[model samples]
Target: MIRQRVIVHGRVQAVGFRFSARVEAQRLGVSGWIRNRNDGAVEAEIEGEAASVDAMLAWLDEGPPGAEVTSLSTADLAPTGERGFRVLS
Candidate 1:
């Protein structure tokens, strides 16, 4: 298993980015949570098979059609042992 924390920048907020991420993560069989940041970025922590996690990160780069992803920064992290994917408030 692999775990990562990612911060995505650009036209992410209020663009259904978090919700889209939740769906994508769930579809990929990943467990994590996504949320909006005050700095206008989207933040998420994903845990799953390495390939699935990597695929989700790649999808995050493009995001929803309305999103203009300018940057994505990810860091290796220990798994949180969470179940299911969700959107955080």
Candidate 2:
């Protein structure tokens, strides 16, 4: 399994980014949580098989149609054996 913490920057807030991420994560059979940051960025931690995690990251790169993702940063993290995805407020 693999885990990653991602911070996405851009016009990411109030554009359904968190909900879209949850749907994508569930579809990919990955687990994690995504939330909006006060700094107008989106933050998330995803864990699952390497391929699934990679897929989730790719989806996050584009986000929903309204999002204009300018940049994103990621860091490796230990897997937590999580089972479902959530959108945190």
Query: What C-alpha lDDT do the candidate models reach, one value each?
Result: 0.93, 0.94
lDDT of 1 by residue, 1-89 (tens): 88999999999998889888888998999998998989999999999999999999999999997999999999999987888998999
**lDDT tens digits, residues 36-73, model 2?**
99999999999999999999999999999999999989
Candidate 2 regions with alpha-carbon error over 4 angstroms:
none
Q: Which 10 consecutive residues of model 1 have the lowest summed lDDT?
A: 14-23
TM-score to native of every candidate shown: 0.96, 0.97
